[model samples]
Target: MTDTALTSEATHGVALSDVAADKVRSLLEQEGRDDLRLRVAVQPGGCSGLIYQLYFDERLLEGDATRDFDGVEVVVDPMSAPYLDGASIDFEDSIQKQGFTIDNPNASGSCACGDSFH
Candidate 1:
């Protein structure tokens, strides 16, 4: 049976694509971590001055906003929400690129490596 994907309306200025949600769900299941959430953040320090942060987090910090896509939950800190507004998280399982990617409309420019933006 194929699992259906349900995306929650963006409350933290971001959304996860169906493929991304599926990948997250599969990963969480593999890790056996139903208590963890996908955390997205933007921190200063990349070559372009800002970089994206993605990880599984078990702690809920103050001012953190969350949204659910299917069974996967994603968290975004208040400081990073603005930068990630309207961004979409996607997953690629191809031979060329096999990982999570962020598409941020708010980015004016990005580094050649695609790891940082300004």
Candidate 2:
């Protein structure tokens, strides 16, 4: 597939939806550190062979791609960038599901738990 992440304004490998960015902003506000960035990365050893790692980080590493949405920022490492290209992150708050979800167009398959992908 094409690397839309590289071509578009979202060089961070993935795009964060408005709701997700807002939630992140809210969380950072709760923590009283709006300077922290949401770091997104890919890791191995999941049931689907690949897993996503997301968290707030204050440090910047080498070869990282960063994107900002309103007041929230997202950072992706070089290695994870290619794998997560064309991916989009969203937040959900409902009785059935309440958390962040990723919509990755490059993933061929995903685990039943929805925490891993291949």
| Per-prediction TM-score | 0.89, 0.89
Model 1 pairs whose backbones collide: none
Clashes of 2: 0
Q: Candidate 1 — worst ten consecutive residues by lDDT sum?
A: 1-10
lDDT, residue 110, candidate 1: 95
The sequence of per-residue lDDT tens digits that candidate 2 reaches over residues 87-116 is 999999999999999999989999999999
Q: How much is 38 displaced in model 1, in angstroms?
A: 0.2
**In model 1, where do residues sit more than 4 Å from their true spots?**
1-10
Tens digits of per-residue lDDT for model 1 on 1-118? Answer: 1111211233597899999999889989999889999999999978899999999998877667888888788999878999999999999889888899999999999999999999
Per-model C-alpha lDDT, please?
Answer: 0.87, 0.87
Candidate 1's TM-score: 0.89
Off by over 4 Å in 2: 1-10
Give residue 25's lDDT in candidate 1 (0 to 100).
Answer: 92
**What TM-score would candidate 2 get against the native?**
0.89
